[model samples]
Target: MDVVIAPDEQIGEIVADDIAALIAARPDAVLGLATGSSPLRIYDAVAERVARKQLSLARARGFMLDEYVGLPPGHPCRYSTVIDEDFVSRVDFAPGAVRGPDGDAADLTAACTDYEESIGEAGGVDLQILGIGTDGHIAFNEPGSSLASRTRVKTLTAQTRADNARFFGGDIDAVPRHCVTQGLGTIMDARRIVLVATGDAKAEAIAHLVEGPVSARWPATVLQHHRRVTVLVDDAAASRLELADYYRHAHAHRHLVS
Candidate 1:
């Protein structure tokens, strides 16, 4: 796995732009996109590139990491609606190129199965973007989750609900307790994964992911077992690491050599 510590959001945008260019070059790019503040800058940069005709989302397929299970399809908190507002609608991707959990699916299990099948039919994800929860969860795969889990429903922990309540107008009661997420097995199937993290709140999780032993309790730490994984962070997010400078310098030297 590779670690990159950018000076600020601009450098983060640059990193995302490079990924956009990579996807553009390979028309069949299938991206696993994440929803949250961490990836907003990256999405903005990619959207601008698409608007300027520098990148094309045509022939590319998009997948979202998770969605609120009980929310209506058009609900503001639904992952589909959020992805549309934040990234998909702003870019030039084909009208139906994006796929996310169906919040309104009558048979939620079948919906998850179909989603997983669709991903498999498309030859799996080329790049999976991720955001780390303050509690070290990734895509709702909370602490103690099975490493081999498949697409399924999950109950939100109190911490997670609290963290997301701000989006629901600070009404924790309005936050949905359940969500549909791709399994750890499904996420690991991706050929490449890029996990983005920011803020001091994420420092402990970031440190554990980078230097701790492999464990399901901290799902993102499983990236250590992947052949192609990149962990990108801003200075604040790398605060808890003892070798933060080493990580920063290594990426710098590697980029220079390349």
Candidate 2:
């Protein structure tokens, strides 16, 4: 686990640097992308690189972390549409190169299974970019989600629905109550994970995910078990961490060791 505490705005370029390196090494690298405010900076940074011809995703593939159930096609809030508008359209990724679980499928169970297979057929994700929910959820794996679960449908917890209401005209009812998400087990298959968080709203969750014991109650805590995980946060988000200074010092001198 590598922890980087820095200004929230600067985090995007830092993460983009690693992503640029990965794309340089593997043109077809599978990238796991997350939606929501937390990861927008990263998407913007990567897109800037693509625009500047510093990097390109034309040959790469992408996978979304989750999707709301029953959103109509072309709905602005739909995860697929949002991903295209936010990242894919900005980059040079080939059409059809990115996919998400079929949230509108008649048989969501089968859709989940197929989504799992789709990821496997892609040789698994090389690097997964993530955002942590204020409640400590990751990819909609709310509290009590199984540590070894796979891609599946899950009910949106009250807190999650409320948090997402802002995206739906500030109406909690406008937010779907159900979603299909990659389970902790599925996310664990990624070769590497980069989680980003900011603001005091995420302080508690970030602290739990980094320093607390692994528990189903805090789904993001599962990352503690992952072999390659990088957690990036700003001062407000990292405020609750017990060893913030140590993490900062280590990051500062990382070049010496590298």
Most accurate candidate by TM-score: 2
Off by over 4 Å in 1: 255-258
lDDT of 2 by residue, 142-232 (tens): 9999999999999999999999999999999899999999999999999999999999999999999999999999999999999999999
Worst 10 residues of 1 by lDDT: 7-16
Q: Which pairs, if any, clash in model 1?
A: none
- Per-residue lDDT over 97-177 for candidate 1, one digit per residue giving the tens place of the 0 to 100 score: 999977578999999999999999988998898899988888988887788888888898999999999999999999999
lDDT for 38 in candidate 2 is: 87
Report each candidate's C-alpha RMSD, comma-separated, in the order given: 1.5, 0.9
Model 2 is weakest, by summed lDDT over 10 consecutive residues, at 249-258
